[model samples]
Target: MSKVVLITGGSSGIGKSIGEFLTEKGFKVYGTSRSPERYTSSKFPILKLDVKVVSTISDCVQSLLEQEDRIDVLINNAGVGITGPLEEIPLEEMKSHFDTNFFGPLEVIKAVLPQMRKQHSGLIINVTSIAGYMGLPYRGIYSASKGALELVTEAYRMELKSFNIQMTNVAPGDFATNIASGRFHAPVNENSPYKTAYGNTLKLMDSHVDSGKDPKIMAEAIFKIISTKNPNVHYKVGEFMQKFSVALKRILPDKMYEKLLLNHYKL
Candidate 1:
């Protein structure tokens, strides 16, 4: 039987690319969106799900189970991007970001665990960010949320090992997608101290997304990971420099790595 896969936020961007790719590879793919009605023409079924809403998460899982009987893979791909000076970003917004990026994924995983455990086999892939590995000037909250998820996955992997269920994080660098338009940007206020730096950094971030690699690359990476018998705890997919930055952080002194970031952002 073909593997049954579920992907959150699969209506577009990286999720959509992965869903389409897997569909062509002969997997039974189901993607989720807040507004599934809008994606009637999607290659695979797009179920209604909003990660921030627990009820929707449960409903999506139950509905899929009724149709497919088993979920071989669960891709926690639903996340929103947020950027701003940490101090200027609203407290509520930070909480909301975490709710979507961290807590939301956790809820989805919980919903699927019973079935995965019953089957005595499954894989859960958390789509994290390369940015999660470091705290960039204007993207600290976004970094923290994803970073928290990364650590949580590390812990979950150990707990699930005996059940033959696998959990891993796939951190991607900037990928050409509609993420920039959907991302939250705390406005740059003229009177605020961070206005100049925040504005410049925000522009740079958008440019990176605009020129990023094709999302198909992420899809291919996902496909390869699913085929592996023993997947690593973490996998990164991105440009050389982006992946190198993580390696550099591991070897460089604290202040020196900080300096590199400051120079890159021209702050």
Candidate 2:
């Protein structure tokens, strides 16, 4: 039988690309959306799921299990983006961002674990961001949330090893997607102290996404990882410099790396 795969936030963007690619490769793929009805034309089925809601996560997993009888792979790709100065972004918004980006994926993983354990084999891939490796000026909240997930996956890999389940993080750099449109942006208030700097950084961030590499790059990387017998704990997909930046952070002094970021954002 072909492997059964579940992807969260698969209605569009990177998740959609992965689902479609896997489907063409003969994997039985299912994708989730907060509004499934909106994606009538998707190549794979779009189940209704809101990662922030435990009940929806449970229902979606149950529904898929009922149909496929097994979930060989779970892609925790459902996440939202938030960009703003740390102080200026509302506290509630920050919490909400965590709910979707961090807690949501955790809940989905929890919902699927029992079944995966019963099968004695499974793979869980958490879709994180390149920004997760370090704090970016305006996208601090996004960095924190994704970064937290990256760490959690490391712990999960050890715990799940005996059960024959594998967990890994795939952090993608900026990809050409609709993420910018959906991201929560704190209004650029003219009188706010961070108005000018925040405004410039925000524009630069969107431009990067606009000119980002194709989503298929992520799809290919994911496919390779899935086929590997002993996958690494973390994999990054993006432009050479974007991936190199992570290495630079490891080798550079704290102040030097900070300076590079400041210069890049022109802060």
Candidate 3:
């Protein structure tokens, strides 16, 4: 039987591309999305799913279970981004980001783990971001969401290794995805309590969205990881700045990194 792979948020962006690439390689692809209409001409199943909705995830998984008894891979790729001064974000906004980006994946894991455990073999890929490893200006919540996921992936890899099931954390750099256009952006006001501290950096980040890495590159990387026999537990894929940024985050002291970030953005 052909293997089955499921990707959340697969209507477009990296997930959509991964679905297409994987389908071409003979995997029975399941692409879950809130807006299935946004994706067209894929030779795989496009299921209506919204990660923020637990029922949506469960119903989608349950439907798949009835048609196919096994799911070989689960790509926890659905996420939402909230941008604003971390200080000014409403508590609910922060919680919602966590809901879509972190908790949502956990829900999917629980829904799918029974089958994976029964099979005694599976791969779970968590789509993270370089920001997870390094705090970035105006990217605090997104960074936090990915950071939380990274740690969880590590723990899962350690725990699941013996079971022959595996976990991989993919930290992709800035990429050309609808995430920039789709994120919830809190209106900024210098007079707002936290804006004065992060406004400039946020502005810079907003401007860079147009010229980051390509979504296809990220998709190709994800496809390879899913196909390979021995993919790394942690994979970083992107342009030079992101690589440099991650390296600096690892080598520099927190205060020094702060200084560099502030000076780089003229904050």
lDDT of 1 by residue, 19-59 (tens): 99999999999999999999999999999999999999999
Q: lDDT value for candidate 3?
A: 0.84
- Candidate 3 residue pairs that clash: none
TM-score for all models, in order of appearance: 0.99, 0.99, 0.93
Task: Give the candidate number with the greatest lDDT.
Answer: 1
Model 2 global lDDT (CA atoms, 0 to 1): 0.96
Instruction: Write down the worst ten-residue block by lDDT for model 3.
Output: 194-203
- Model 1 deviation from the true structure expressed as Cα RMSD, one decimal place: 0.5
The 0-to-1 C-alpha lDDT of every candidate, in the order given, reads 0.97, 0.96, 0.84
Residues 1-267 of candidate 2 have per-residue lDDT tens digits of 899999999989999999999999999999999999999999999999998889999999999999999999999999999998888899999999999999999999999999999999999999999999999998999999999999999999999999999999999999999999999999999999999999999899999999999999999999998999989999999999999999999999999999999999998
Candidate 3: misplaced stretches above 4 Å?
Answer: 37-41, 193-199
RMSD of each: 0.5, 0.5, 1.8
- Candidate 3: tens digits of C-alpha lDDT, residues 158-183: 88887788889988887777887778
> What does candidate 1 score on TM?
0.99
